[model samples]
Every structure is written in structure tokens, then in C-alpha cells.
Target chain A: MASPIQENLVSKNAEYASKFTKGDLALPPAKHYLVLTCMDARIDPAAAFGIDLGDAHVIRNAGGSARDALRSIIISQQLLGTKEIILIKHTGCGMLTFSNEDAHGLVKKNLGPSAAAEIATLDFLPIKNLDDAVKGDVEYLKRSAAVPEDVIISGWVYEVETGKVRRIV
Target chain B: MASPIQENLVSKNAEYASKFTKGDLALPPAKHYLVLTCMDARIDPAAAFGIDLGDAHVIRNAGGSARDALRSIIISQQLLGTKEIILIKHTGCGMLTFSNEDAHGLVKKNLGPSAAAEIATLDFLPIKNLDDAVKGDVEYLKRSAAVPEDVIISGWVYEVETGKVRRIV
Candidate 1:
């Protein structure tokens, strides 16, 4: 059963399509950079980060996990010619609300024992300190085998409350 | 030194923050769904998909690769409470432009031998066909033990030229 919001997506998209004009952008991003950020609904990467049409690749995940995003990051840089990266985690992220044990318990309680066992080895990538996580993700990218040494990678924290970004590294 | 556009990011972000609102939404998405789509700047997932504040988690990557997004998908559904998935790929994506070998050669040519050696085994997750790719990703998510069987996963192809999405699975 499609939800009302899902149905709205189709109709609203049609309206957007009627007025859309920036559909002829190039394959590779014009600015030749990429950003790894969270899938937080509070943030709009395009508007908040000032990324124009066909400007950059934005790889977003749960915690903005660098490890989770590395595969796409490699492809973005190697295949698409992006030379820089901006990794942005945010304040008040749900990833900060729980530990691995907490996540496991939630899975077991909500999904069942089989589902819990299925994800037993999974890392939720939870972080205790926001600043440390940002700096660590930047450092991880710097040391990554897949990321070239010359590719400039910086880290920042996007404050969902204030809609401001604070550079952490 | 930040690029000219990177500098624009700071200035633009400041402008956005000055008028920011709607930062008090709940932790869980209001609509309890997620959209796994491409990082292509041409597509604005929020506006195109009619995702309002705190509506859904939008997981984006190169080619909108579901394999790359699996970790976050698990977290979004299990840890968070999203019950549905919208897997949307687009036409004429950069992922369709190159194969793994082409990416490897570009890595070597652009970043030298050592960098090429680092990502020698990378799977760029390139798609040869758009509709088939969307179906395949939906199937992949359905087959994954991590994704619950009851979770409604649908596939669509977002046409960059026409700005319309066609259902594939």
C-alpha cells in the first residue's frame, strides 16, 4: 500500500518536471568534488552546502560513516574525476543516541531473534563524541588505501539546530 | 586553500542559516520510509520526491548502489523505524560511462601507480541498463537477510531529461 506521501511524490514530481530547466548538466560534476554526509532529513545538502547543478557528488549514510561510504568515494574520485572531499556529520544525530549493544537489543526486541542473529556482526558506527568522530573520519580517509594522498579531505559538523557548519579538522 | 566554489559554500551556508527554521523534528522520520538514490546533482531528492522536513532518510551514492547503501539501510530500518524503501536510479548517470577497467586506468593515469594499486579490486557498481539496474537493486535489497521481508521496496528510474520517474519493480 502506497502511503499518501508516496502518492504526493508522484504528483509533485510531475509539477516540478513541468518547470525543470537544469536537465542538461554534464556527466562529471563541474566543481570536481564530493561530500560524505549523514542522511539526516534536517539537512538539504544542495541548499545548505551551495552545490549548484552538477557540481559535486554527495554520498550520504547513517552516521556519514566513512567506511560505509568508501566504495562510492573511490568510484566518485577515480571514475568521475573529483579531487576533494567534504565529510560532514551533524549535531543531535540519532547515531549518537545508542551503542552497539543498544542497537542489538532493539533489533532483537523489534525484529526477532533470527533478525538479531543476522546482524550480530554489524557495527552501528555509533559515536560518543561528535568532534572526535569528525576528526577520526577525516583521519581515516587520509590513511585509506583507496583514497589518494593528494586528495584534500576536510571534516565538519553541521548543526541541525543552528543550520551552521563547524569545521572540526 | 578552499576552491572558489568551496568558499561559496561557507558564504551560502551562512545565508541559509540566517533564515533557518524547523529544527525540532523528532528522531524518527515522520513518514517512516527511506529513499536510496543517486548523488547526481541534477536530481534534488527532497523536492523531486516531495520529502518534507523529517519525512525520510535519503541514502545516496555513486549509481545509487544498493550494495553500498545496505549498511545504512539496515540502520535506517532496524535502528530507526523506517518501514519502506524507494530505490531510485536515473538515466545517463556517470556510472554508465565507465567499467572497472576504465576506472582503474583513470586512477593510474590521474593519481599514479600506487594509487591505482590501492583500488585495484574496486567494484565501481556501474550499470549498463537503467531499468534493469533499478530492478536488480530492488531484488538485491529483497534478498538481503538484513532487510526485513515485510519492508516494501520499490524501484524507479528517474529520467534526468524529462524529470519524471518510471516504476520498474
Candidate 2:
């Protein structure tokens, strides 16, 4: 039996595909930029950030961690020609509510010691301050040699409370 | 002075926030699911996958790589109560067009030796066969100790040309 989510995806995608066009868009983003944001459900990068289809790449992960996004960002910039990055972390993020130890403990409790051991060395990249987290990510990208010096990178805080995004750095 | 992207984000966000209302959604995804998809510019997870705000966590990386997404997935499933994972890769994915060495070479060419050294050992997680990639991600999650045995996992492919998704595993 297909799950409800799976069913919904099929039906919704059918609707979207029926109206789909622009199948000839190129591999590289048309606008030469990417947005790195959290995977938080509340923030839809395309609608919330004004990105149109084929315009930009969107790299999202927990806390919108730039460190975790390094590989993708490098590919986006070096190979595919994205020249700018807009990295946005958000308010009331799950990352802000826990520490690495807390995450380790949760895995230990939920999936046992083997699972805990699997993630023992992992850094959850939790943040205590939203503004500082955004600024820190911007600085990390700026200083990283993998990220070219000329690529414009800015950071922002998305207010999940209000569907608004404010620049942080 | 704001860049065009920055200025556009501020103005566009103001329009979104002007009518924003769902401020009471909880941190845990309301539907207890997460969608892992590529950061491809043409794929919009929310619109394409039928995810509503607060419905599910959406994790995107270069290839919708389960390995790259492991930490975030663990946090989502273990700490935040997401019970299902839908991992989706896509047609015309940038990952489909390169090897790890190709990525490394590009980094060296574009950002020089120091930048290359920084990501010398990094795996860009490029995909060779799209079906195998999706199946591999599904199998990886299914077998991972960090992802609980009871968690439902499925894989799919999003056709950039058609705006359609078809099940893979």
C-alpha cells in the first residue's frame, strides 16, 4: 500500500506536470545564484525567497549549516557558475533548541547504542543565537578557500513567525 | 548597497509577510515526515511534492544525497519526530554529469591549489545512474542504524522536463 504522502505526491505532481513547460532550461542556473537555507518545513525557498523555476539552486539542510553545505556550494559555484549565495537560517529552529550531546543522546535513546556510535563524531551544528549563526555562516563561506573570493555571499534570518526574511550580514 | 538578489528578497518577502498567518505551527513536522530532494533550480519541493507549510522537513543537497543528508535526517527523525523519509533525485541533475575527480579538477581550476586542498578528500556524491542513485539512497536509509527500522523510506525521480515524479524504490 502506498503511503498517504506518496499518493499525494503522485496526484499533485500530475497536476504540476500537466501545466509544465520550459523543458529546455539549461543545466546552470539562469540567475547565477543559489540559496542555502534550513530544511524547516515553514520556509519554502522558492516562494519565500522569490526564486523562479530555473533561476537559482537551493541547498537546504538542518540549521542551514554552511559547513555541511560546502560540497554542494562548491559544485554550485565552481562547476555550474553560480556567482552569489544567499544563506538563510531561521527563527525558532530545531538546531537552536539542542546541542550535539542532546542529539547524540536522542539517537542513543531512539535507535540504541549502535546508532549513537554511528553518529558519535558528528557535529549537529546547533546554534544558540540566530543572528550570530547567520553571520557565522556568511563569514565561514567568505573565508573558505573552496568558495572563491569574488562570489558574493550574504546571510539572513527568516522569521518563521511572520514569513519575513531580514539580512544579517 | 544591496545586490539585486538581496534587494529582490527584501521586497518579495515583504509581500509574503504582509499576509502571513501560520505562526503557531510546532517545531516537529506536523505530518511526521521529511522529503529529501536535490537543490536543483528546477525542482521546487513544496509545489512539486505537495508539501504544505509545517507539513514536512525538506532536505536538499546537490544530489539529494542520503549520505550528505544523514546528519539532518537523524536530527529530523530522532529528535524532531519525523517518521517517514521520501528521498528524491532528479533528471538532468548536475550530479549526473560529473565524477568526483571532475569536481575536484574543477575546484582546482576555478579556485586554485589551496581551495583544492580544502576539499581534496570531499566527495561531491555525483550520480552515475539516476535509478541506482535513488535506490541506493533508499537502501542506505533502510539499513542505517541511525534511521529506525520502523521508519518508512521510499525513493522517487523528479523529471525536470515534465515536472513529474515516478517511484523508484
TM-score of 2: 0.98
Tell me how each candidate scores on DockQ against the true complex: 0.64, 0.84
Candidate 1 wrong stretches, greater than 4 Å: A113-120, B112-117
Model 2 pairs whose backbones collide: none
Clashing pairs in 1: none
* Single-chain TM-score of chain A, each candidate: 0.96, 0.98
- CAPRI grade, predicted model 1: medium
Task: Write one digit per residue (lDDT tens) for candidate 1, span A73-111.
Answer: 888777778889989999999889888898888778876
Estimate every model's Cα lDDT from 0 to 1: 0.84, 0.90
Winning model by DockQ: 2
Error of 2 at A148 (Å): 0.7
User: What DockQ score does model 1 reach against the true complex?
Assistant: 0.64
Winning model by lDDT: 2
